[model samples]
Target: MARNKYDIDEALDSEFNIKHLKRLGTYISPFRKDMAITILLMLTSSALGMLVPIFFMKIIDDFIPNKNIAGIVGVCFLLLVINIINMINLRLKVNITAKLGQNIIHQIRSDIFTHLQELPFSYYDDRPHGKIQVRVVNYVNSLSDLLSNGIVNTITDLFSLFFIVGFMLSIDIRLTGICMIGLPVLMALIFFIKRKQRVAWQIQSNKSSNLNAYIAESINGIRVTQSFVRERENIQIFNNLSKSYSTSWMNAVRYNFMLWPAIDNIATLTTAAIYVLGVSWITNGVAGITTGVLIAFTSYIGRFWAPINTLASFYNSLLTAMSYLERIFETIDEEVTVKDNEGATEMPPIVGDVEFRDVTFSYEDGVPILNGVSFHVKPGETYAIVGPTGAGKSTIINLISRFYNLDSGELFIDGIDINSVTIKSLRKQMGVMLQDSFIFSGTIMDNIRYGNMEASNEEVVAAAKTVCAHDFIMGLENGYDTEVNERGSRLSAGQRQLISFARALLADPKILILDEATSSIDTETEILLQEGLAKLLAGRTSFIIAHRLSTIKNSDKIMYVDGGQIIELGNHDELMALEGKYYDLYMSQYDFLR
Candidate 1:
């Protein structure tokens, strides 16, 4: 649970257009076989329906006039048979598209989540976490039906419109011309609403993202809010986001609902004109426009408009999906700034030796976190980094782990450039214990096993024991099997750190990074942890960032970092003897305590 960088009211642009259709088509490509089958079935169903009106015309003109009872009964049976086939086709289409829709949703969401895992920390630092979650969950779900049913339905409807119009013209060209008078009106209405409706829906989507982001941030910071008695302020912020969403939603829906009524009215007027004109020609005894032909022609008019109405709904769904897909693609398209280079190989066994030559890096351009800073640690040595707030102490550990590529420089492990190896292989051999140690919701044993998935239960317990966590864990009612919620609410902050320390230890890494990992532990617990760690990491290379004097006093070297450079470096006594930055920092703490 972490708060976002910006306010919830932050506005977003509506970039929804036809461009995302190409990316969406790629997802649909894998299931083209199912789509082909669905299309064939739907067209067959439409063809079957089209035959019914013609059969009725035969009964009206020939069967009933001659008192041919068998012909009328046979036509009824044939229509019934046609309807049963259409029903069967409808059922099969539903089955295929249902599975198709879910599979596509699964694949798209999996791709988005996988890309998120590969994204650098800087990508996350720039956006709200909830925004990313929405793309995977909400945005993908909203487009599922559109990708499946809406697509196939629109295709069949377009083909159906063609067949109906062709039949109408065959009956009587004059009557067909009258029926088509509404086509331009329907097209004009759709064109006029297209951009406005898409923009409205896009606004609604942004508001929804904002509301969800704020809700997630509020839940994470509930303790802080309650501590400061700011419940009323949070409620006000939520209400404002919700109101914006509601307004945009109403506007989009108003435009959406407008299409149906306008289309229905146009169809109604056109059908009336067809009835009047067709009957007038038949009554006048015009050639090729008999009573049977007039009846069949009017039926085709209904069939023609039916698909037109449905096509409008499909257009609405497609536009809605376009707005959502824009956000989803934005996340999927984010660059992986720290990925491996071409021909990168798996990192060979990491030795303790590490070096950074003329390294320069930054979180933001023109604002260096570490500039031209260089350091080297010998095998089996411990080095501590000490610095003021905003100094580059944490950046050193981050660079060691290769979380971000250096803006300009070379970082080597055991004399081999780190950029020459696969990121997974590089990180696998290291253990990092950060200040904010996240404990997922599960049994304590499960949490520890996460560090080493292949570790036996005995190994997990041994690591816990080495970190002085076994005593407290065994003291719990269920021992190591006790369930803990996320952030380890059941355990104290110090206990959580002990469990995290045990997790990191279980990795058995050659290079260990502890970034303020002991800050939460009590004096007594810290002392016990230090005793265990001294023996455990004796032969390993370890980097410890600590403010507590006792924690780093025995390090082989200590560096005082400030203004993006290591201003002072030496062993503890040697640095204190120089009366430099390290001495002043240590003496200040010493004075504060005394």
Candidate 2:
């Protein structure tokens, strides 16, 4: 079944595969000693437990019948000792497995988060942030129970089944066969329910993810919604998503709740059959059919079905947890498309000379964003790029940052091919300020310090002053120490951009990119920031993208980009003299102002 939802769940392999089990060995491998001890403890406790019913049978048959009080008391003491041993085994098992489970969870979470860090921008560009957050936080937590107790209990139960069956068959082959009737029935029930249950849970997972994605998006865009008077419409959409989630959840749990009753019914019917047949056969003076033996056989029947019940419950739990694991591992297994190539080296000291030779690229295959465009920028020069929206202007800055690999041609930095160096080293030498300035939840001092962690507070203050942010920041009650929330909602748009300027310049990068850096500020503030911009750009190669022609008229050189290629390239004065596309663009803005 498919639902009309924003988050489309990827198809999972519904068929049960042993590979999932094998894959678990990677995490469990670290705590092999702990696992071995936990399994041994489980088996030992189960063994001790199996002997209880037998001892009870002995008391009824051999001890009380012969008036042997001493034997009864002796067996009673042994049972107490066995109980104590079982308790100890359980305590140890919980301690070891609990610790092991936590460690495994940490490792798996760390691995996913680490992989996410290495994954290219394109990975996140295609998915919602909330969907990614759920996998990292929710899906990993779901594995806790299965990792903690399910594995050991499953192994111990399987062994106990064998031991119990052997003891039963030795007591009476005919009765044992009668008890065996329920095993196939239980298996058949699971066989029928397994696929439906898995599919139901998978759909539930999809709905949950969709609901989370929508909630996150809604919260982030609440300001827009309120301003546009879309609150009622948004609430209606949210209600629909909530209802869908509730329905899918109930459907999944329907299959989950069905197992216990069916298993119990089969066990109840099997036990009743045994009692009727045993009593009738004994009345006919059947050979080797003593009262004690009949009692013991019934006792073993209860023992036999208990594990089957547990296995049934665990089987259900396994199928449910695997739905979550499928997503978790799928994320872990997502290939790091833009990572350090083999034997990639640290980038050498940058001189800011940048060149793109016949470079081609596309966010989607066959839908090219940049078509074989090429350019060269000399060190210490400031270049401004002007273009209409979707004309691949920002794509150039991103290419220079090496956030994306070229689709075909080569991009070189300081005459070195970009792909030959490690990404961390490459990015460290350049500073980029995007249109949206994201602030972490911390003191303003900490936010600016994020650029260069080793910079002293004095350095941070110096950078803030250079960006014209110091006057407003000092105007606050706490000055640089004032706390700000993530996304910087407390700060004005212009103030945030000023802080962003401080952050970008704090790194003292050789190459700097400012994409619409001053668009949000008024002309008066923009004029003040230009002095700070002059200081920051001294001896550094800079690329500025802006629609306001007044801001970039004095750029060392300007390139009017359009239709996936450069249409005009010259200094501001030269471009104005050419009276081509650049002149038309500048004249239109000038005419509007005039």
TM-score of every model versus the real structure: 0.95, 0.94
* Candidate 1 local lDDT, 249-280, one digit each (tens): 89988999998898889888988877787778
Model 2 has a clash total of: 0
Which candidate ranks first by lDDT, i.e. highest? 1
Q: lDDT of each model, Cα atoms only?
A: 0.88, 0.87
Deviation (Å) of 292 in candidate 1: 4.0
Clashing pairs in 1: none
Looking at candidate 1, the ten consecutive residues that score lowest on lDDT are: 1-10
Task: Report the number of clashing residue pairs per model.
Answer: 0, 0
TM-score of 2: 0.94
Angstrom error at residue 149, model 1 = 0.4
- Model 2: per-residue Cα lDDT at residue 76: 94
Q: What is the C-alpha lDDT profile of model 2 across 185-241, one tens digit per residue? A: 878878898889989988888888878888888999999999999999999988988
